[model samples]
Target: MLPSLLLLFLSIPLTTVTAASAAPRCTTSTPIKTYQKCMNLPTQGASLAWTYHPHNATLDLAFSGTFISPSGWVAWGLNPDSPAMTGTRALVAFSDPSSGGLLLLPFILDPGVKLQRSPLVSRPLDLPLLSSSAMLRSDSSVRDGAGLHIFATLRLSPNRTRINHVWNHGLYVQGYSPTIHPTSPSDLASRATIDVLSKATEMGPAVPSWFRTAHGVLNAASWGFLLPVGVTVARYLRQCTSVRPTWFYGHAAVQIVGFLLGTVGFSMGIIMGRASPGVTYTLHRGLGVAAFVTGGLQAAALLFRPKTTNRYRKYWKSYHHFVGYGCVVLGVVNVFQGFEVMGLGGSYWKLGYCLALSTLIGVCVALEANAWVVFCRRAEEEKVRREGRVEEHQVVKASIGI
Candidate 1:
């Protein structure tokens, strides 16, 4: 009976050991109470100072601090002899701006557990940071043991305004001390930031990005379609001697095409800008309006009777030039603006378009100016020849006594 009892006891010990080995080292995390004591071990050999990242970033303050290392590396003073070192609870502190209190964010270390949060639409976040990402901040990482020891640098985002709205924010962590559910582990970290800025609920620009992209493109396209019509009119004004039927046909065809295209493009741009309100979107709107008004006026000019005199034609030419150039300029400006809002990156598109336009404009202006100069020179020469012919005829008649 005594041998049987001894064998049962020995078997019990083996089963317990197996169960313990299979179980995780850490799984549950406890929150740090403000009243809880933070233990600091005597540093004999600590890892380099544990890097400190602030919860809220302030001007004139550095985002840094010290921490304990599990290895007792030299960075922080290590005392392997301390019970806290073995137990894993030490200190996580931030400096209090007033009176220099060591504000501690404490945690009982755990591993692989996470605390998730949904963004609050109505409540204001309690943070001094100007980053919108603070909405997703969690205290899961308050505990440790995921083998990630990062020197986090939490700072305010530089983006201030979106659709005249201000965004406030701070750091978000996963597996943070679960404020809502306390039994979760502590090894979670959020790589994606939440919010730094937001637009007002009533703003037109409060629409989503995909919607804005579609709309803005349409507006821009509408503006562009009108361009070819103006270009044709400009060419005719410069080259046509008589306003022939073909000239009017060419103008009418181009106008029809331009208006159709511009309308589609304009509608799209409005939709897109309303969807994504930003600096680029503002420009897109302004340029779109300008294109529409100028194009409308140019088309309307057809209703007015132009004078028959050559000089009056020149006068009409000035109006045509103004409207044509205005439409062209607006179309071109919006194209670049669209590309910018799309975040197409770098000066790649801008540079290419600039070089092409500059070359084309330069060639046209030079040729037009040369043509005018030659025409004036020819007129002067012809005037001199006609006068000389009259003078010669008069002299010949006098000598013949006729």
Candidate 2:
């Protein structure tokens, strides 16, 4: 995992590449009705142009993609519903290493995820590939390697006057890694919208992109880092005699703030899930729930804190330690899972969290060492004082006897 992240960060700074048509290559002699848009990406970028012929019920799509490596896969697809991979009808193209010819196939993202595994098996699809309907051209616009130009003419339903508002996304697999398939998790990372001859203007994703960003940042900082910081204060700083009750108050304050932020972040995620019908992150959701529940338990425990003289004080301490640490671990793990779910596993968000967590661990280690040293010194002083008292008692007994 670490190596993959290093590789991703090393390769993510993308370069701009253009695939200019030498001349106007509209499908028809007359001015073609066309729509064009571009989406910038981390590894590469894509520009899509489509022409609609209402009379013939045909849609001509040209997808030009920049490539970081020459050998691998690139796909452009229309998802009938949301912009997720599981429901997309994709036109997949890859350079066959053995045959040295570009092979194009029509694939459907199925209900099951097995199709996303390596050695991608041919699957049944709703859209049939028209005879000689696919075309591939070399684009020398990219400096690192040649780009891929994929063009296809697809048939639309009869009597359909306007296109439905649908999601369009693209994917690229770098090099020929056997484990990586077209429908793999990483392939779902890049996407863009396509509006072609739709009467209702698309409003955009169910949850705005900015909202998702906020959700990730808030939860990761609160649950992942700040909560742990509060735990550290209660564990280590509370022992400092000089600080007295300040550490207790500080711990309570930080924990309260972290819980509030985490609650807001968790709510955003729930809203986002409702906004997109077919898209779901099951593991991320589960982990998030577990963290939230345990965190709530810890907070509620504060209300029933046992007094130091209470017979159940040991039980309360045990419960607090177990739940608090468990919650912290889950929160941190879920944050990483959220990053992957958002296609940001290698992004700076993950990097920043890692750096913060690392700093916290360093602080804990330093403080623990100082605490142990102070404890040892106090123990030594107490032992010496006891020895002195015993000597003085012995001397007084000897003088009285004389």
Candidate 3:
């Protein structure tokens, strides 16, 4: 619960990070030259237009992407080796420091760039390029938001009709070097394979929505719902003399089920993380890992539980209470973090979860108040019985003395 409170405080600002509005499609007409073919790219609200000449395999292309800010940089590139970005020979465009005009330079994205060992620098691409140029445009109807267009003419190999393309935008440039781009889902998924011979385009693989939904549901049920209920049962129900060991069994069953479901959910999260490389949610991942480890420890402690009459029973109970509550707190907090990480901060799913959790907390509060009332009543009855016995004893002593 303490962890949940802390998470609530931290998550207050996450609600403001809404998704960007839709971007307009790419326009066929350009100020300089016209393209024969054009297609809207899948991610980052970007688009590509090109004209391929079959005789000499000359290709004229224009890639357009929106700027995140005034000082940001945009890039478009082709990878001859594979469909990924590691080996891509790219052309990056940014504002020139001297003239405040558009500056275009070629860069090769190597393994070092992916590993972040060194800053990205400009160099000549290995591809056969006839010419390259770039310009900034402010037309909202053609390209929504601040936009930049990269134009290039490259000579391709004979009979080459397929090409892999990558494009991305960044928020900063240190001196003349462009810094690493944002690692959000949209940014990392900005690659596609396009057929120069036709209008066909295949986007890069993305994590399925159903998989993410399942992960969120399972974790929410286990960590967010069931675990708290189990803790509540143990805390309140066990006090009833009629329930006795029944409460213990109920608590154990609920906890075991919750833990099992949480294990599956945690495994799914790990799989998703592996599937989407170069994307990281640091706080969410850390909280998840801590909760999982703490939950596992709590589960394992049941095996070494001390006997009821044992001298170590009190210490064992203390350990169990501390760890159990800690796990519950971490689980609840991580569930909220999961919502933010999945970009469902303002979705109906979060609202439903919040309503259910609030209901549970309300139930716990009512039960706590009732338990206090029962305790006070019993204590008062015990005191009255003691006073009655004392008065009767005094009456008997007085009669015997007379």
Best-fitting candidate, scored by lDDT: 3
**Candidate 3, which segments miss by more than 4 Å at Cα?**
1-207, 392-402
**Clash pairs, model 2 backbone:** none
Backbone clash pairs for candidate 3 read none
Q: Count the backbone clashes (under 3 Å) in each candidate.
A: 37, 0, 0
Could you give candidate 1's per-residue lDDT for residues 266-334 as a string of tens digits?
A: 776665444332223357668778878887887788677387664678777789778878887787777
lDDT of 2 by residue, 149-174 (tens): 56666777776534322223233433
Candidate 1 global lDDT: 0.41
The lDDT, on a scale of 0 to 1, for candidate 3 is: 0.83
Assess every candidate by TM-score.
0.43, 0.59, 0.56
Question: What ranking emerges by lDDT with the best candidate at the front?
Answer: 3, 2, 1
Cα RMSD for candidate 3?
11.7
Model 3, backbone clash pairs (residues 3+ apart or across chains), number = 0
Best of the two (1, 2) by lDDT: 2
Residue-level lDDT of model 3, residues 166-280, one tens digit each, is: 8999887777788888765567667767788886665533444356777999999999999999999999999999999999999999999999999999998888776553345
RMSD (CA, Å), each prediction = 22.1, 9.8, 11.7
